[model samples]
Target: MKIIAALVTASINKPVSTTIGLLILFMLSAMTVVAEQLPPPSATTEYSKEGADTCLQCHDQDSKFPVLAIFNSPHGNKNTKHGPFSSAGLQCETCHGAAAAHTVKRLRKGQVRAAMISFKTKDVISNDEKNQLCLACHQATTTRHWLGSVHQSNDLACTDCHQIHISDDPILNKAQQLEQCGQCHTKEKVANHSVFSHPLTSGQMGCTDCHSPHDANNNQLLVSDSVNETCYQCHAEKRGPFLWEHEPVTDNCLNCHRPHGSNQAALLTQRAPYLCQNCHNSDGHPSFSYGSDDAQGQQASAFLLGRSCANCHAKIHGSNHPSGYKFQR
Candidate 1:
């Protein structure tokens, strides 16, 4: 402290240099503190000696904790050089860690110790620790942005969405994917069941089609740079650099349309006329009310009876026509 004080006093005449020196010292001190706080690297255990064969003895089809089904999965494919079982023949211990204590011969009939790393066990390490085991292999690929991803920040483990030992991971299957996502996103699940929703129930579309749940550069984990860009994936016709563009449509699709689902037709945030009224309250026609009484009237009643404001403004999304300034075609 005295040495730092003396240095600061000596450099007082040169404020910029003194500040820079102080910053460097602070950074070095922080680095040293961080180094001291880090835990020691774990030592290798004996469980890797016999590979999956040893684990299969106690985790066979007949055992309560059957792991033989893993043979049907891609991880069990010994033909693939990059597979867990084939790569350096690590197999079970590659994920579960070295189980030196758990594998030891039991002295008593009722004595059973825990494995080195158990995903299902309560009070193990932590979600982050469990994720590290998976990220060790995945960090280079699909999970490249996983370090600061929303799932990582929320402490979501890889096992929460993936079933490793099973022959099929439910989250990967389109038919079963929503069920897995719905476990956490209850609101989206309910929205899919709305009167006007994307064909999620029919398996025509999936959450992953729009969202990269692993990691994304956009908000809401969208696969594209923006919500409008994501919607343009399927609604390509609406992606026009038109002669006349609807301000809200060009700005954001969510301005008038709901991505998930809605009670109104065409996934509209609200029915026409009322929805258009919110934005278009011009002098006469655009501001006119479309009530039941108007049904008794003449030509104007026809617009109110059917699609309302959309009756005349058919090209409401956008228009390429030279005379489409009002988005009416």
Candidate 2:
């Protein structure tokens, strides 16, 4: 480029004594010598000569950024198959994108900013784009259903719960997972805090045990085909091939139970007599009927003294005995 500029200058600075033929030849040579072409501003994205090493210049442990911890993460493990530093031998650029233009000094809207995708910078990458960076290598079984999932639809970023620089992400820890998910799930948190609820707060179970955050096949994000199927995993006794099957039990446990929590005992939606009356006809059985005695043509208390419907119908879920038509075997 310098040679071309010098040649052009010499051609233009020729004195009057110079021959027209010589001047014309110099002008022609200068015209033929095109300046060394450079890519336009839009095409400035190029890989730096040094990859991760370049990024470490500013992100090293001594710096405020402190990215040396990533070396201890799976992403930096060169032996891990198909990982960021695996057979492909990718570096920081593999996830952060090309740094050639980003490393070079630049200004945007009166602010000095990186030209490439630096996740910390505003607008450098959208949530979807940030997810794609991880999906580039993580689009596997667990992630297959991640697309269009509730978390994805809400523009959730993997970094929101995962700490890629560390070996153990908070979401992967049993005790920490509840709190991590609870940050955004305040309603479920309150439900789990209730007296009668799944043992989530105590760490006996995790949200992932019942809900598949990666899946959106159902509104509850249950890991199983249906609500009953999910419950049957732990309450196999309730999943009976009984001689007398309760319709509500077989249909859905939620019909009679609050899955998360409830003020009622055994997570029941309501105290039994009223709850049973929702589906059971009070006049059908004169013994437990709450209907007026005048309508029944008999006199009997409303069973309010010891009126929990499930107290007598102990096998309310189902009954294996032949004579258990009323679920009281």
**What do the candidate models score in CA lDDT, each in turn?**
0.79, 0.76
Clashes within 3 Å, all models in order: 0, 0
Clashes (candidate 1): 0
Candidate 1, residue 165: CA error in Å?
1.0
RMSD per model, one decimal = 5.4, 13.3
> For model 1, what is the alpha-carbon lDDT of residue 83?
70
User: Compared with the true structure, what per-residue lDDT tens digits does model 1 show for residues 137-156?
Assistant: 67675788887888888888
Show pairs that collide, candidate 2: none
lDDT of 2 at 27: 67
What's the lDDT of the predicted structure labeled candidate 2?
0.76
Q: Candidate 2's residue-wise lDDT over 1-329, tens digit each?
A: 56556555765867655546555766676666543343222223787787777778788778877777877878888887787777676587787776677776456677765566655535466877888888878878778888788889988888887777666677876667779888998887778777799888788888889988777478788888899999999999999888899999999999999978888888988877889989988785643534444444465444433456765688999998888888877
Model 1, residue 92: C-alpha shift (Å): 0.1
Provide the TM-score for each candidate, comma-separated: 0.82, 0.74
lDDT of 2 at 182: 88
